[model samples]
Target chain A: MSLLAEIAVSVLIVIGASFALVGSWGLLRLPHLMARLHAPTKATTLGVGSVLLASMVYFFAIGKGVSMHELLIVLFLFLTAPISASFLARAYLRAHVAPDVLPPAGEQGWATFARRSDDAHDAPATSATRAPPQD
Target chain B: MSDAGLLDHALAFGFVAFGLALLLNLLRLVKGPTTTDRVLAVDTMVIDVIALIVLLGIRQSTQAYFEAALLFAMFGFVATVSFCRFMLRGRLVE
Candidate 1:
């Protein structure tokens, strides 16, 4: 290999490494599940894409011919990451329903248990209240 | 130093930095608070692994590394999808 080619390959590696570093940084720095999802989906995708492109270049330059394998990997990644992130975020939302949104505990138990118990005990009384006038 | 020498140095430094990044991602995978966070971290880690495989393919000048990258991509997608479905429905099977 010529000197220029070697230098180019080295430069490509460095660029790829920098992208990986930034992606990792974003993963660590982002706060909250929803916010952290953004980091890997966006930064990491591009970062890995660049590195794979560099690899494609290095291989082709070395007379390996054009490689489409990395391209396929990139396509699969682009297709899947977003769908997974959205599913997870939705799951998180469902699981984290606000406590304030729930009815008070006593009211809930009364409505759930006491109402049924009262209906069972006061069947005739309830019927009398409902009967218009069975004279 | 000659150009070959410079290139060798660059490759070494790049690999080192890439390794560091992989480690950082692994840390997130280990310590992530929620299932979603861990899944995200794992996704990022797998992407980094694919990149690393490509780098290895270049560094070693072997076509076999491409196969690994391809497999990682395929299986990683399946894994992510399954995990997401599990999180959403709380079951892997409907």
Candidate 2:
């Protein structure tokens, strides 16, 4: 291993480590689920890429030929992380709303009554509470 | 290995940093208030693991670890896709 090669390796490693650190920091600092999703999705993907590139350089510089298989992993990661994040967000929204579709403010009944009264002028009082004007 | 000493040290440093990243991600996994948070944490962890495997390959001077890293990446993708599909459709089978 020549001095130049050693220096190059060290540089690569430092770059990779810095990326990982940034990704972690983003994880801790970001607010909310939707916002937090961006941190790992972008930072971590680049972090992993940097580290993998460092490894490839380290091995190949030493006469190990090309080890580009890590590229496949990078490809897969980039493809899936976003999809999962979106799906999870959608699911969270659905679950959060399922229980509160109707609030207990008595507003629903009032709206129904108003509509019934408008439709059945002949029997406003009876139609208001009985059903909904059968319309 | 003198010429490569600095490189080795740098790689080692990367390993340590990556370990810390893993810990931070784990914290997110533990403290996430929503399912999306947990899923994001898991996704980040998978990425970190893949990076770790590649670093290990460099450290050990072997190409074998690449295979494991590759597998992890593939599985992570599949798992993420399936989880997302489940979230969207409310059922993995459907």
Candidate 3:
């Protein structure tokens, strides 16, 4: 490999590794589940993406031709990370927070853990009164 | 210094850094207060592990590990989705 290519690979690897390190640090030190969620999903995704880019560039420079497989992992991570985060957020809301405590959802109703309008209609009107709002 | 020597040094540094990140992620996984936090830790670990595998592939100049990394990403996504689904629905299957 050429010296220039080696330097580029080194820079990419270091940046990627640093991002990963900061991301895990956030995970360890963040105060709450909601706050901690932001750290890993965004930073770790970028961290891994950068590292994969380094690998692709390194292989290309080494006369191994072009390797496109790493792109698959990048695509998968981007697509799934937000979805899993969303699911977890909804789960946390459903288990811990009462519907009335949530910020009003306007005309559409609660964004997550929305009881079906029909179920809302059939249940005792006092159901909302029984469960105290958390936070 | 030779190009190979530089590359070797960089790879060594990368391996150590990524290994440390992985260990810290495990720490969060064990100590996280909520199930959601643990799930997020595992999610981050999966990404870090993928990065480590790609770094290893670069160091070794091998293409075989690419497929392993891709497979691992797929598995991690599936696991996260299912775990979230269970948490959301209170059951794995409908």
Candidate 4:
């Protein structure tokens, strides 16, 4: 590889690795679950995206032929991270928070708790109510 | 210096950093107050491993790890979604 390409690859790798470390650190240290959810999903996604870009460029510079397949991983991560985060959030909500405490959202109520939250007895209070989920 | 001088140093740094990140993720997995936290930690660990695999591909200049990384990403996402789904609905399919 040429000098410029080598430097670029190194820089990208370093940046990607640093971001991954910081994101994981945030995941471990953040005080609240909601705050914790945002850290790795965003930072590490970008972290790996950088590494993938670096991989494409490094291989191209080494005369291995152009390969654009890494973009598929980037695109997949972008599409699914949020969906998973939403699922985790809904899981947290369904398992922990009482629905009545939530702000009103029409007759149907919020989709997460709408089916079971109305009964009140089912969820009770917080995760302590994990027993007898009923279904 | 050498032909692979700066690049080798960077790869070493990258490996150590990612390895440490994985350790931190494991710590979170162990100590997380709730199940949601553990699932999130594992998801992050999978992503970090994918990135590590990409770095390996770059280091070896091989194309094989490319498919591996992609498959890891795909499997990680599906696993995370299913775990969350099971948690939310109390059933994997509903």
Off by over 4 Å in 1: A2-4, A97-135, B1-3
* Of candidates 2 and 1, the better by lDDT: 2
Alpha carbon deviation, residue A40, candidate 1 (Å): 1.4
Per-candidate TM-score against the hidden true structure: 0.76, 0.77, 0.88, 0.89
Instruction: List the RMSD of every prediction in angstroms.
Output: 11.8, 10.9, 4.5, 5.2
- On TM-score, the leading prediction is 4
Error of 2 at A40 (Å): 0.6
Considering DockQ, where higher is better, how would the candidates rank from best to worst?
Answer: 4, 3, 2, 1
Interface RMSD of each: 9.2, 9.6, 4.5, 3.4
Worst 10 residues of 3 chain A by lDDT: A120-129
Query: Candidate 4, which segments miss by more than 4 Å at Cα?
Result: A116-135, B1-4
* Local distance difference test, each candidate: 0.69, 0.69, 0.79, 0.83
lDDT tens digits, residues A2-96, model 3? 88988998888888888888888888988988888888888888888888889888888879888779888788888988988888777677656
Model 2 spans > 4 angstroms off: A96-135
| Fnat, 2 decimals, each candidate | 0.69, 0.74, 0.69, 0.77
The global Cα lDDT (0 to 1) of model 3 is 0.79
Could you arrange the candidates by TM-score from highest to lowest?
4, 3, 2, 1
Predicted candidate 4 versus true structure: per-residue lDDT over B1-94, tens digit per residue: 2386899999999999999999999999999999999999999999999988888877777888878888888999999998877777666643
Compared with the true structure, the alpha-carbon lDDT of candidate 4 equals 0.83
By DockQ, the best candidate is 4
lDDT of 2 by residue, A79-127 (tens): 7767766666655554443323334434343232233212323321222
